[model samples]
Target: MSRTPDFLAQGHDERDPSPWLALYLDQSTPLPDEVKAAWLTDSSSGSRQYLLPFLRPVARLTIILIQVVKVFVPRNWSHSKLLHRLLAWGLKRFVSPEANWLILRHFHLGSQVLGFIGRNSPAPVGTSPLEPADIDALKDETFLKHDLNLFNFVIRLNQALRDKGLVLGKAPQVDFSMIRDPGLRLSDMPHGKLNFLDLQSAIELFTPLYQLMLTDNDFWRAANSLQLDETIGIYAATLLGAPEHLILVNNKHPLVPLSTLRAGHRLVIHGLSTEMLHSLLRRMQAAHGATPTPEQPLA
Candidate 1:
Protein backbone atom coordinates (compact mmCIF):
# COMPACT_ATOMS: atom_id res chain seq x y z
CA MET A 1 0.00 0.00 0.00
CA SER A 2 3.01 2.24 0.39
CA ARG A 3 3.60 2.37 -3.35
CA THR A 4 1.64 1.71 -6.51
CA PRO A 5 0.85 -2.00 -6.66
CA ASP A 6 2.89 -4.07 -9.09
CA PHE A 7 -0.02 -5.06 -11.32
CA LEU A 8 -1.12 -1.47 -11.82
CA ALA A 9 2.48 -0.52 -12.50
CA GLN A 10 3.08 -3.29 -15.03
CA GLY A 11 2.78 -1.37 -18.27
CA HIS A 12 3.46 2.06 -16.74
CA ASP A 13 6.84 3.74 -17.13
CA GLU A 14 7.93 5.66 -14.05
CA ARG A 15 9.62 8.44 -16.00
CA ASP A 16 6.50 9.45 -17.96
CA PRO A 17 3.01 8.54 -16.81
CA SER A 18 1.16 10.72 -19.27
CA PRO A 19 -2.21 9.02 -19.72
CA TRP A 20 -3.03 6.96 -16.68
CA LEU A 21 -1.29 7.59 -13.38
CA ALA A 22 -0.11 11.12 -14.00
CA LEU A 23 -3.48 12.66 -13.16
CA TYR A 24 -3.97 10.32 -10.25
CA LEU A 25 -0.63 10.25 -8.42
CA ASP A 26 1.65 13.02 -9.65
CA GLN A 27 1.54 16.08 -7.38
CA SER A 28 4.76 17.85 -8.23
CA THR A 29 3.44 20.27 -10.85
CA PRO A 30 0.35 22.43 -10.61
CA LEU A 31 -2.60 20.25 -11.75
CA PRO A 32 -3.92 22.88 -14.12
CA ASP A 33 -0.61 22.87 -15.96
CA GLU A 34 -0.56 19.08 -16.06
CA VAL A 35 -4.12 19.05 -17.35
CA LYS A 36 -3.30 21.53 -20.08
CA ALA A 37 -0.33 19.44 -21.13
CA ALA A 38 -2.31 16.19 -21.06
CA TRP A 39 -5.12 17.75 -23.06
CA LEU A 40 -2.85 19.17 -25.71
CA THR A 41 -0.90 15.91 -25.94
CA ASP A 42 -4.03 13.79 -26.43
CA SER A 43 -5.50 16.25 -28.88
CA SER A 44 -2.34 16.35 -30.97
CA SER A 45 -2.07 12.59 -31.43
CA GLY A 46 -5.59 11.31 -31.90
CA SER A 47 -7.85 11.01 -34.96
CA ARG A 48 -10.26 13.36 -33.24
CA GLN A 49 -8.91 16.45 -34.94
CA TYR A 50 -9.22 14.82 -38.35
CA LEU A 51 -12.77 13.68 -37.79
CA LEU A 52 -14.03 16.65 -35.83
CA PRO A 53 -15.00 18.70 -38.88
CA PHE A 54 -17.08 15.88 -40.30
CA LEU A 55 -18.42 14.55 -37.01
CA ARG A 56 -19.18 17.87 -35.37
CA PRO A 57 -22.20 18.60 -37.48
CA VAL A 58 -23.50 15.09 -37.02
CA ALA A 59 -22.91 15.28 -33.28
CA ARG A 60 -24.66 18.59 -33.06
CA LEU A 61 -27.61 17.35 -35.07
CA THR A 62 -27.82 14.27 -32.94
CA ILE A 63 -27.96 16.39 -29.83
CA ILE A 64 -30.70 18.49 -31.33
CA LEU A 65 -32.71 15.40 -32.23
CA ILE A 66 -32.30 14.02 -28.74
CA GLN A 67 -33.53 17.24 -27.21
CA VAL A 68 -36.51 17.28 -29.55
CA VAL A 69 -37.30 13.66 -28.78
CA LYS A 70 -37.14 14.33 -25.08
CA VAL A 71 -40.07 16.68 -25.49
CA PHE A 72 -42.34 14.13 -27.18
CA VAL A 73 -41.21 10.88 -25.62
CA PRO A 74 -41.59 9.87 -22.02
CA ARG A 75 -38.34 9.70 -20.07
CA ASN A 76 -39.05 6.06 -19.22
CA TRP A 77 -38.80 5.16 -22.91
CA SER A 78 -35.02 4.94 -22.56
CA HIS A 79 -35.52 1.95 -20.28
CA SER A 80 -37.85 0.13 -22.66
CA LYS A 81 -36.90 -3.52 -22.56
CA LEU A 82 -37.78 -3.97 -26.21
CA LEU A 83 -35.55 -1.09 -27.28
CA HIS A 84 -32.65 -2.43 -25.23
CA ARG A 85 -32.93 -5.86 -26.78
CA LEU A 86 -32.90 -4.37 -30.29
CA LEU A 87 -29.84 -2.25 -29.49
CA ALA A 88 -28.12 -5.20 -27.87
CA TRP A 89 -28.78 -7.32 -30.93
CA GLY A 90 -27.27 -4.71 -33.21
CA LEU A 91 -24.20 -4.28 -31.01
CA LYS A 92 -23.58 -8.02 -30.83
CA ARG A 93 -24.08 -8.55 -34.54
CA PHE A 94 -22.31 -5.49 -35.90
CA VAL A 95 -19.79 -4.04 -33.46
CA SER A 96 -16.26 -5.27 -34.10
CA PRO A 97 -14.67 -7.28 -31.31
CA GLU A 98 -11.78 -4.85 -31.15
CA ALA A 99 -14.08 -1.93 -30.41
CA ASN A 100 -15.93 -3.95 -27.82
CA TRP A 101 -12.64 -4.76 -26.14
CA LEU A 102 -11.88 -1.08 -25.79
CA ILE A 103 -15.34 -0.39 -24.38
CA LEU A 104 -15.06 -3.07 -21.72
CA ARG A 105 -11.49 -2.15 -20.86
CA HIS A 106 -12.60 1.32 -19.80
CA PHE A 107 -14.85 -0.16 -17.13
CA HIS A 108 -11.98 -2.26 -15.83
CA LEU A 109 -9.76 0.79 -15.65
CA GLY A 110 -12.48 2.83 -13.94
CA SER A 111 -12.90 0.12 -11.34
CA GLN A 112 -9.18 0.07 -10.69
CA VAL A 113 -9.14 3.84 -10.20
CA LEU A 114 -11.98 3.60 -7.73
CA GLY A 115 -10.39 0.69 -5.91
CA PHE A 116 -7.09 2.48 -5.57
CA ILE A 117 -8.78 5.53 -4.05
CA GLY A 118 -10.75 3.35 -1.66
CA ARG A 119 -7.76 1.41 -0.46
CA ASN A 120 -5.46 4.39 -0.14
CA SER A 121 -7.85 6.85 1.46
CA PRO A 122 -8.61 6.85 5.17
CA ALA A 123 -12.39 6.84 4.82
CA PRO A 124 -14.29 4.96 2.12
CA VAL A 125 -14.73 7.49 -0.69
CA GLY A 126 -16.72 5.41 -3.19
CA THR A 127 -17.04 1.96 -1.70
CA SER A 128 -20.67 1.12 -2.33
CA PRO A 129 -20.41 -2.53 -3.27
CA LEU A 130 -23.14 -3.99 -5.43
CA GLU A 131 -24.98 -6.87 -3.84
CA PRO A 132 -25.27 -10.28 -5.54
CA ALA A 133 -28.75 -9.44 -6.72
CA ASP A 134 -27.55 -6.08 -7.92
CA ILE A 135 -24.72 -7.72 -9.80
CA ASP A 136 -27.14 -10.12 -11.48
CA ALA A 137 -29.41 -7.25 -12.41
CA LEU A 138 -26.49 -5.34 -13.87
CA LYS A 139 -25.41 -8.33 -15.91
CA ASP A 140 -28.88 -8.73 -17.31
CA GLU A 141 -29.18 -5.02 -18.05
CA THR A 142 -25.76 -4.90 -19.66
CA PHE A 143 -26.54 -7.91 -21.81
CA LEU A 144 -29.73 -6.24 -22.95
CA LYS A 145 -28.46 -2.70 -23.40
CA HIS A 146 -24.66 -2.84 -23.63
CA ASP A 147 -22.34 -5.51 -25.04
CA LEU A 148 -22.60 -8.78 -23.13
CA ASN A 149 -19.98 -10.50 -25.25
CA LEU A 150 -17.43 -7.90 -24.20
CA PHE A 151 -18.48 -8.39 -20.60
CA ASN A 152 -17.80 -12.13 -20.82
CA PHE A 153 -14.48 -11.49 -22.53
CA VAL A 154 -13.26 -9.30 -19.68
CA ILE A 155 -14.49 -11.84 -17.14
CA ARG A 156 -12.38 -14.53 -18.78
CA LEU A 157 -9.44 -12.15 -19.10
CA ASN A 158 -9.59 -11.34 -15.39
CA GLN A 159 -9.75 -15.01 -14.52
CA ALA A 160 -6.76 -15.75 -16.73
CA LEU A 161 -4.81 -12.99 -15.03
CA ARG A 162 -5.71 -14.47 -11.65
CA ASP A 163 -4.68 -17.96 -12.76
CA LYS A 164 -1.31 -16.57 -13.76
CA GLY A 165 -0.88 -15.08 -10.24
CA LEU A 166 -1.46 -11.53 -11.38
CA VAL A 167 -3.63 -9.43 -9.14
CA LEU A 168 -5.61 -6.50 -10.44
CA GLY A 169 -7.68 -4.41 -8.11
CA LYS A 170 -11.32 -5.39 -7.88
CA ALA A 171 -14.13 -3.05 -6.83
CA PRO A 172 -13.67 -1.36 -3.48
CA GLN A 173 -14.85 -3.15 -0.35
CA VAL A 174 -16.20 -1.71 2.90
CA ASP A 175 -18.30 -3.00 5.80
CA PHE A 176 -21.75 -1.72 4.95
CA SER A 177 -22.88 -2.32 8.53
CA MET A 178 -20.56 0.38 9.75
CA ILE A 179 -21.62 3.03 7.23
CA ARG A 180 -24.23 5.74 7.76
CA ASP A 181 -25.65 5.73 4.23
CA PRO A 182 -25.54 2.01 3.52
CA GLY A 183 -28.39 2.41 1.05
CA LEU A 184 -26.38 4.64 -1.25
CA ARG A 185 -26.80 2.83 -4.57
CA LEU A 186 -26.11 4.27 -8.00
CA SER A 187 -29.70 3.58 -9.03
CA ASP A 188 -30.90 6.24 -6.61
CA MET A 189 -29.07 9.04 -8.40
CA PRO A 190 -30.70 11.02 -11.21
CA HIS A 191 -27.90 10.38 -13.67
CA GLY A 192 -27.64 6.75 -12.57
CA LYS A 193 -31.21 5.89 -13.50
CA LEU A 194 -31.55 3.24 -16.17
CA ASN A 195 -33.67 5.60 -18.21
CA PHE A 196 -31.52 8.69 -17.81
CA LEU A 197 -29.50 10.27 -20.59
CA ASP A 198 -25.98 11.05 -19.43
CA LEU A 199 -22.48 11.30 -20.84
CA GLN A 200 -21.49 7.69 -20.17
CA SER A 201 -24.64 6.42 -21.82
CA ALA A 202 -24.22 8.95 -24.61
CA ILE A 203 -20.68 7.67 -25.28
CA GLU A 204 -21.92 4.07 -25.45
CA LEU A 205 -24.78 5.10 -27.67
CA PHE A 206 -22.33 6.98 -29.89
CA THR A 207 -20.43 3.77 -30.63
CA PRO A 208 -23.18 2.60 -32.93
CA LEU A 209 -23.81 6.05 -34.32
CA TYR A 210 -20.22 6.73 -35.31
CA GLN A 211 -19.19 3.20 -36.19
CA LEU A 212 -19.11 4.05 -39.89
CA MET A 213 -17.36 7.37 -39.46
CA LEU A 214 -14.44 6.17 -37.37
CA THR A 215 -12.06 3.28 -37.23
CA ASP A 216 -12.35 1.11 -34.15
CA ASN A 217 -9.15 2.59 -32.71
CA ASP A 218 -10.26 6.13 -33.41
CA PHE A 219 -13.62 5.58 -31.84
CA TRP A 220 -12.09 3.99 -28.76
CA ARG A 221 -9.64 6.80 -28.20
CA ALA A 222 -12.28 9.48 -28.63
CA ALA A 223 -14.72 7.64 -26.42
CA ASN A 224 -12.06 7.03 -23.77
CA SER A 225 -11.24 10.72 -23.63
CA LEU A 226 -14.87 11.64 -23.11
CA GLN A 227 -15.24 8.89 -20.51
CA LEU A 228 -12.30 10.34 -18.65
CA ASP A 229 -14.33 13.53 -18.34
CA GLU A 230 -17.27 11.56 -17.02
CA THR A 231 -14.94 9.77 -14.62
CA ILE A 232 -13.92 13.13 -13.18
CA GLY A 233 -17.56 13.98 -12.62
CA ILE A 234 -18.01 10.64 -10.90
CA TYR A 235 -15.14 11.44 -8.56
CA ALA A 236 -16.89 14.69 -7.74
CA ALA A 237 -20.14 12.90 -7.05
CA THR A 238 -18.50 10.45 -4.70
CA LEU A 239 -16.31 12.89 -2.81
CA LEU A 240 -17.88 16.32 -3.23
CA GLY A 241 -21.64 15.74 -2.90
CA ALA A 242 -22.53 16.49 -6.50
CA PRO A 243 -23.90 13.56 -8.50
CA GLU A 244 -25.60 15.34 -11.38
CA HIS A 245 -22.37 17.06 -12.38
CA LEU A 246 -21.25 13.94 -14.26
CA ILE A 247 -20.89 15.51 -17.68
CA LEU A 248 -18.74 18.19 -19.37
CA VAL A 249 -21.44 20.44 -20.81
CA ASN A 250 -20.70 23.35 -18.50
CA ASN A 251 -17.64 22.15 -16.56
CA LYS A 252 -15.08 23.08 -19.23
CA HIS A 253 -12.28 25.33 -18.05
CA PRO A 254 -13.01 29.01 -18.64
CA LEU A 255 -9.88 30.05 -20.52
CA VAL A 256 -10.50 27.48 -23.23
CA PRO A 257 -13.97 27.90 -24.66
CA LEU A 258 -13.77 26.00 -27.91
CA SER A 259 -16.23 23.13 -28.09
CA THR A 260 -13.65 21.10 -29.99
CA LEU A 261 -11.21 21.20 -27.09
CA ARG A 262 -10.36 17.76 -25.60
CA ALA A 263 -8.43 18.57 -22.49
CA GLY A 264 -8.81 17.33 -18.90
CA HIS A 265 -9.27 20.60 -17.03
CA ARG A 266 -12.26 19.31 -15.06
CA LEU A 267 -10.60 15.93 -14.68
CA VAL A 268 -7.41 17.36 -13.22
CA ILE A 269 -9.23 19.76 -10.92
CA HIS A 270 -11.58 17.15 -9.47
CA GLY A 271 -8.86 14.52 -9.34
CA LEU A 272 -6.60 16.72 -7.28
CA SER A 273 -9.52 17.69 -5.07
CA THR A 274 -10.20 14.02 -4.39
CA GLU A 275 -6.55 13.42 -3.49
CA MET A 276 -6.48 16.38 -1.15
CA LEU A 277 -9.71 15.23 0.52
CA HIS A 278 -8.18 11.79 0.96
CA SER A 279 -5.18 13.33 2.64
CA LEU A 280 -7.44 15.18 5.07
CA LEU A 281 -9.40 11.99 5.72
CA ARG A 282 -6.18 10.09 6.43
CA ARG A 283 -5.17 12.71 8.95
CA MET A 284 -8.61 12.64 10.57
CA GLN A 285 -8.52 8.86 10.85
CA ALA A 286 -4.99 8.95 12.27
CA ALA A 287 -5.95 11.47 14.90
CA HIS A 288 -9.24 9.91 15.97
CA GLY A 289 -9.38 6.38 14.54
CA ALA A 290 -13.13 6.96 13.98
CA THR A 291 -15.31 6.73 10.93
CA PRO A 292 -16.25 10.12 9.55
CA THR A 293 -20.01 10.51 9.19
CA PRO A 294 -21.32 10.52 5.65
CA GLU A 295 -22.49 13.84 4.23
CA GLN A 296 -26.25 14.37 4.10
CA PRO A 297 -27.83 12.03 1.57
CA LEU A 298 -27.21 13.51 -1.87
CA ALA A 299 -30.42 15.35 -2.83
Candidate 2:
Protein backbone atom coordinates (compact mmCIF):
# COMPACT_ATOMS: atom_id res chain seq x y z
CA MET A 1 0.00 0.00 0.00
CA SER A 2 1.18 3.50 -0.74
CA ARG A 3 2.19 5.34 2.42
CA THR A 4 -0.32 7.95 3.60
CA PRO A 5 1.03 11.43 3.14
CA ASP A 6 1.93 13.38 6.25
CA PHE A 7 -0.32 16.40 6.00
CA LEU A 8 1.80 18.13 8.61
CA ALA A 9 5.11 17.31 6.98
CA GLN A 10 7.01 20.46 6.15
CA GLY A 11 8.73 20.89 2.77
CA HIS A 12 6.14 18.67 1.14
CA ASP A 13 4.80 20.20 -2.07
CA GLU A 14 1.37 18.59 -1.97
CA ARG A 15 0.34 18.67 1.71
CA ASP A 16 0.43 21.49 4.26
CA PRO A 17 -1.64 21.28 7.40
CA SER A 18 -2.23 23.73 10.26
CA PRO A 19 0.28 23.94 13.10
CA TRP A 20 -2.67 23.58 15.47
CA LEU A 21 -3.00 20.06 14.14
CA ALA A 22 0.60 19.51 15.14
CA LEU A 23 -0.31 20.38 18.72
CA TYR A 24 -2.50 17.32 18.79
CA LEU A 25 -0.24 15.03 16.76
CA ASP A 26 3.26 15.92 17.97
CA GLN A 27 5.18 13.43 20.07
CA SER A 28 6.26 16.03 22.62
CA THR A 29 2.63 16.66 23.56
CA PRO A 30 1.19 13.28 22.88
CA LEU A 31 -2.51 12.62 23.33
CA PRO A 32 -3.29 9.27 24.87
CA ASP A 33 -4.17 6.62 22.33
CA GLU A 34 -7.08 5.38 24.41
CA VAL A 35 -8.57 8.84 24.54
CA LYS A 36 -8.36 9.05 20.77
CA ALA A 37 -9.93 5.63 20.41
CA ALA A 38 -12.68 6.65 22.79
CA TRP A 39 -13.40 9.74 20.69
CA LEU A 40 -13.67 7.60 17.57
CA THR A 41 -15.91 5.07 19.31
CA ASP A 42 -18.15 7.78 20.70
CA SER A 43 -18.48 9.36 17.29
CA SER A 44 -20.12 6.23 15.89
CA SER A 45 -21.61 4.65 18.98
CA GLY A 46 -24.96 2.90 19.00
CA SER A 47 -26.27 5.17 21.76
CA ARG A 48 -25.71 8.22 19.59
CA GLN A 49 -27.17 6.57 16.49
CA TYR A 50 -30.33 5.47 18.28
CA LEU A 51 -30.84 8.70 20.18
CA LEU A 52 -31.05 10.70 16.92
CA PRO A 53 -34.63 9.60 16.21
CA PHE A 54 -35.84 11.07 19.49
CA LEU A 55 -33.53 14.11 19.43
CA ARG A 56 -34.61 15.32 15.97
CA PRO A 57 -38.17 16.22 16.91
CA VAL A 58 -36.95 17.79 20.18
CA ALA A 59 -34.40 19.89 18.33
CA ARG A 60 -37.05 21.15 15.89
CA LEU A 61 -39.30 22.01 18.82
CA THR A 62 -36.43 23.84 20.47
CA ILE A 63 -35.98 26.03 17.38
CA ILE A 64 -39.64 26.90 17.43
CA LEU A 65 -39.57 27.68 21.15
CA ILE A 66 -36.50 29.85 20.74
CA GLN A 67 -38.14 31.82 17.96
CA VAL A 68 -41.26 32.26 20.09
CA VAL A 69 -39.16 33.47 23.00
CA LYS A 70 -37.18 35.87 20.82
CA VAL A 71 -40.42 37.54 19.73
CA PHE A 72 -41.28 38.13 23.38
CA VAL A 73 -37.75 39.10 24.49
CA PRO A 74 -35.47 41.60 22.83
CA ARG A 75 -32.17 40.32 21.46
CA ASN A 76 -30.32 42.49 23.97
CA TRP A 77 -32.13 40.73 26.76
CA SER A 78 -30.48 37.50 25.68
CA HIS A 79 -27.32 38.89 27.24
CA SER A 80 -28.98 40.51 30.19
CA LYS A 81 -27.56 39.85 33.65
CA LEU A 82 -30.92 38.46 34.79
CA LEU A 83 -31.01 35.80 32.09
CA HIS A 84 -27.35 34.94 32.59
CA ARG A 85 -27.91 34.51 36.28
CA LEU A 86 -30.82 32.20 35.64
CA LEU A 87 -28.80 30.18 33.16
CA ALA A 88 -25.90 30.04 35.54
CA TRP A 89 -28.23 28.76 38.26
CA GLY A 90 -29.50 26.03 36.02
CA LEU A 91 -26.01 25.03 34.88
CA LYS A 92 -24.80 24.83 38.44
CA ARG A 93 -27.73 22.74 39.60
CA PHE A 94 -28.07 20.45 36.63
CA VAL A 95 -24.92 20.07 34.53
CA SER A 96 -22.56 17.23 35.36
CA PRO A 97 -19.10 17.98 36.74
CA GLU A 98 -17.58 16.00 33.90
CA ALA A 99 -19.34 18.20 31.37
CA ASN A 100 -18.23 21.37 33.13
CA TRP A 101 -14.63 20.20 33.15
CA LEU A 102 -14.88 19.37 29.47
CA ILE A 103 -16.29 22.85 28.78
CA LEU A 104 -13.52 24.60 30.71
CA ARG A 105 -10.83 22.44 29.14
CA HIS A 106 -11.95 23.69 25.73
CA PHE A 107 -11.19 27.29 26.69
CA HIS A 108 -7.76 26.22 27.79
CA LEU A 109 -7.20 24.47 24.48
CA GLY A 110 -8.47 27.54 22.62
CA SER A 111 -6.07 29.77 24.53
CA GLN A 112 -3.21 27.47 23.61
CA VAL A 113 -4.24 27.45 19.95
CA LEU A 114 -4.51 31.26 19.78
CA GLY A 115 -1.34 31.72 21.78
CA PHE A 116 0.53 29.34 19.53
CA ILE A 117 -0.67 31.24 16.50
CA GLY A 118 0.21 34.61 18.01
CA ARG A 119 3.69 33.64 19.16
CA ASN A 120 4.73 31.70 16.07
CA SER A 121 3.52 33.89 13.23
CA PRO A 122 6.09 36.01 11.39
CA ALA A 123 6.42 39.72 12.13
CA PRO A 124 3.96 42.08 10.37
CA VAL A 125 1.47 39.19 10.09
CA GLY A 126 1.15 38.11 13.72
CA THR A 127 -1.16 39.18 16.53
CA SER A 128 -0.13 41.83 19.02
CA PRO A 129 2.00 40.40 21.81
CA LEU A 130 -0.31 38.69 24.28
CA GLU A 131 0.16 39.22 28.02
CA PRO A 132 -1.27 37.79 31.23
CA ALA A 133 -3.69 40.71 31.40
CA ASP A 134 -4.85 40.07 27.87
CA ILE A 135 -5.60 36.50 28.81
CA ASP A 136 -7.56 37.71 31.87
CA ALA A 137 -9.52 40.11 29.69
CA LEU A 138 -11.05 37.02 28.11
CA LYS A 139 -13.05 36.59 31.30
CA ASP A 140 -14.56 40.07 31.27
CA GLU A 141 -18.28 40.27 30.53
CA THR A 142 -17.81 43.03 28.02
CA PHE A 143 -15.54 40.83 26.01
CA LEU A 144 -17.55 37.60 26.29
CA LYS A 145 -20.35 36.49 28.56
CA HIS A 146 -19.18 32.95 27.83
CA ASP A 147 -15.93 33.55 29.72
CA LEU A 148 -17.99 34.46 32.76
CA ASN A 149 -19.81 31.20 32.24
CA LEU A 150 -16.40 29.55 32.21
CA PHE A 151 -15.57 31.06 35.56
CA ASN A 152 -18.90 30.08 37.07
CA PHE A 153 -18.57 26.53 35.75
CA VAL A 154 -15.05 26.22 37.09
CA ILE A 155 -16.06 27.28 40.60
CA ARG A 156 -19.05 24.99 40.70
CA LEU A 157 -17.16 22.02 39.28
CA ASN A 158 -14.33 22.49 41.70
CA GLN A 159 -16.75 22.63 44.61
CA ALA A 160 -18.41 19.48 43.41
CA LEU A 161 -15.09 17.75 43.00
CA ARG A 162 -14.10 18.74 46.51
CA ASP A 163 -17.30 17.29 47.86
CA LYS A 164 -16.42 14.03 46.17
CA GLY A 165 -12.83 14.02 47.53
CA LEU A 166 -11.36 14.76 44.09
CA VAL A 167 -9.67 17.86 42.75
CA LEU A 168 -8.66 19.11 39.32
CA GLY A 169 -4.90 19.42 39.12
CA LYS A 170 -5.25 22.80 37.50
CA ALA A 171 -8.08 25.14 36.66
CA PRO A 172 -8.25 26.35 33.09
CA GLN A 173 -6.27 29.55 32.41
CA VAL A 174 -5.64 31.59 29.27
CA ASP A 175 -1.92 31.81 28.57
CA PHE A 176 -1.84 34.49 25.89
CA SER A 177 -2.74 38.18 25.85
CA MET A 178 -3.75 40.53 23.05
CA ILE A 179 -2.67 44.13 23.56
CA ARG A 180 -4.88 45.26 20.66
CA ASP A 181 -7.27 43.81 18.18
CA PRO A 182 -5.69 41.94 15.28
CA GLY A 183 -8.36 43.54 13.08
CA LEU A 184 -9.07 40.32 11.13
CA ARG A 185 -12.65 39.41 10.40
CA LEU A 186 -14.08 36.21 8.88
CA SER A 187 -16.46 38.46 6.95
CA ASP A 188 -13.46 40.01 5.23
CA MET A 189 -12.04 36.64 4.32
CA PRO A 190 -13.07 34.91 1.09
CA HIS A 191 -14.97 32.39 3.16
CA GLY A 192 -18.66 31.68 2.66
CA LYS A 193 -21.29 30.34 5.01
CA LEU A 194 -20.75 26.65 5.68
CA ASN A 195 -21.92 24.39 2.84
CA PHE A 196 -23.10 20.95 3.87
CA LEU A 197 -22.05 19.59 0.53
CA ASP A 198 -18.41 20.04 1.54
CA LEU A 199 -17.67 17.46 4.21
CA GLN A 200 -14.95 19.50 5.93
CA SER A 201 -17.09 22.63 6.06
CA ALA A 202 -20.03 20.65 7.30
CA ILE A 203 -17.92 19.15 10.10
CA GLU A 204 -16.51 22.55 11.06
CA LEU A 205 -19.96 24.06 11.30
CA PHE A 206 -21.36 21.40 13.61
CA THR A 207 -18.26 20.37 15.56
CA PRO A 208 -18.53 23.43 17.78
CA LEU A 209 -21.99 22.47 18.99
CA TYR A 210 -20.71 19.25 20.49
CA GLN A 211 -17.25 20.41 21.58
CA LEU A 212 -18.11 23.74 23.14
CA MET A 213 -21.86 23.46 23.56
CA LEU A 214 -23.16 26.95 24.40
CA THR A 215 -19.71 28.51 24.98
CA ASP A 216 -18.36 28.65 21.41
CA ASN A 217 -19.55 32.18 20.66
CA ASP A 218 -16.80 33.94 22.61
CA PHE A 219 -14.07 31.66 21.24
CA TRP A 220 -15.03 32.51 17.66
CA ARG A 221 -15.27 36.19 18.53
CA ALA A 222 -11.87 36.01 20.18
CA ALA A 223 -10.55 34.22 17.10
CA ASN A 224 -11.78 37.11 14.94
CA SER A 225 -10.45 39.72 17.37
CA LEU A 226 -7.05 38.05 17.32
CA GLN A 227 -7.32 37.76 13.55
CA LEU A 228 -6.81 34.01 13.78
CA ASP A 229 -8.41 33.32 10.40
CA GLU A 230 -6.15 35.85 8.73
CA THR A 231 -3.12 34.81 10.73
CA ILE A 232 -3.71 31.18 9.90
CA GLY A 233 -4.08 32.23 6.30
CA ILE A 234 -0.68 33.86 6.44
CA TYR A 235 0.84 30.74 7.94
CA ALA A 236 -0.81 28.66 5.31
CA ALA A 237 0.50 30.87 2.54
CA THR A 238 3.92 31.63 3.96
CA LEU A 239 4.87 29.40 6.89
CA LEU A 240 3.38 26.04 5.94
CA GLY A 241 4.86 26.75 2.52
CA ALA A 242 1.68 25.80 0.64
CA PRO A 243 -1.07 28.17 -0.43
CA GLU A 244 -3.07 26.18 -2.92
CA HIS A 245 -4.61 23.88 -0.32
CA LEU A 246 -3.76 25.74 2.89
CA ILE A 247 -5.43 29.08 2.34
CA LEU A 248 -8.60 29.43 4.39
CA VAL A 249 -11.94 30.15 2.78
CA ASN A 250 -15.38 30.43 4.29
CA ASN A 251 -17.95 27.99 2.85
CA LYS A 252 -21.72 28.07 2.98
CA HIS A 253 -23.38 24.98 4.44
CA PRO A 254 -27.05 24.29 4.98
CA LEU A 255 -28.00 22.95 8.38
CA VAL A 256 -30.08 19.79 8.15
CA PRO A 257 -32.01 19.71 11.42
CA LEU A 258 -31.90 15.95 11.68
CA SER A 259 -28.22 15.74 10.91
CA THR A 260 -27.43 18.45 13.42
CA LEU A 261 -29.44 16.77 16.11
CA ARG A 262 -27.70 13.45 15.48
CA ALA A 263 -24.25 15.04 15.40
CA GLY A 264 -24.88 16.91 18.61
CA HIS A 265 -26.12 13.84 20.41
CA ARG A 266 -23.22 11.72 19.18
CA LEU A 267 -20.59 14.25 20.23
CA VAL A 268 -22.05 15.11 23.62
CA ILE A 269 -22.51 11.48 24.57
CA HIS A 270 -18.93 10.50 23.80
CA GLY A 271 -17.19 13.81 24.43
CA LEU A 272 -16.73 13.44 28.18
CA SER A 273 -14.94 10.73 30.09
CA THR A 274 -12.89 10.76 33.28
CA GLU A 275 -9.76 9.78 31.40
CA MET A 276 -10.27 12.30 28.63
CA LEU A 277 -10.98 15.14 31.04
CA HIS A 278 -7.95 14.41 33.19
CA SER A 279 -5.74 13.93 30.16
CA LEU A 280 -6.80 17.30 28.79
CA LEU A 281 -6.12 19.09 32.07
CA ARG A 282 -2.72 17.48 32.24
CA ARG A 283 -1.95 18.58 28.70
CA MET A 284 -2.94 22.14 29.54
CA GLN A 285 -0.84 22.14 32.68
CA ALA A 286 2.15 20.79 30.79
CA ALA A 287 1.79 23.48 28.15
CA HIS A 288 1.83 26.13 30.89
CA GLY A 289 5.01 24.66 32.49
CA ALA A 290 3.18 23.17 35.45
CA THR A 291 3.74 19.62 36.63
CA PRO A 292 0.74 17.36 36.25
CA THR A 293 -0.31 15.89 39.58
CA PRO A 294 -0.93 12.20 39.07
CA GLU A 295 -3.41 11.89 41.91
CA GLN A 296 -5.68 14.68 40.75
CA PRO A 297 -8.73 13.26 38.96
CA LEU A 298 -12.15 14.45 37.86
CA ALA A 299 -15.28 13.20 39.55
- What C-alpha lDDT does candidate 2 achieve relative to the native structure? 0.33
Off by over 4 Å in 1: 1-56, 80-84, 125-139, 142-299
Using Cα atoms with residue i matched to residue i, what is each candidate's TM-score against the true structure?
A: 0.33, 0.36
Residue-wise C-alpha lDDT for candidate 2, range 28-72, written one tens digit per residue: 423464333223333333434464455456654554454455455
Predicted structure with the largest TM-score when compared to the true one: 2
Off by over 4 Å in 2: 1-32, 79-102, 123-238, 242-299
In model 1, what lDDT does residue 259 have?
29
lDDT of each: 0.35, 0.33
Which candidate ranks first by lDDT, i.e. highest?
1
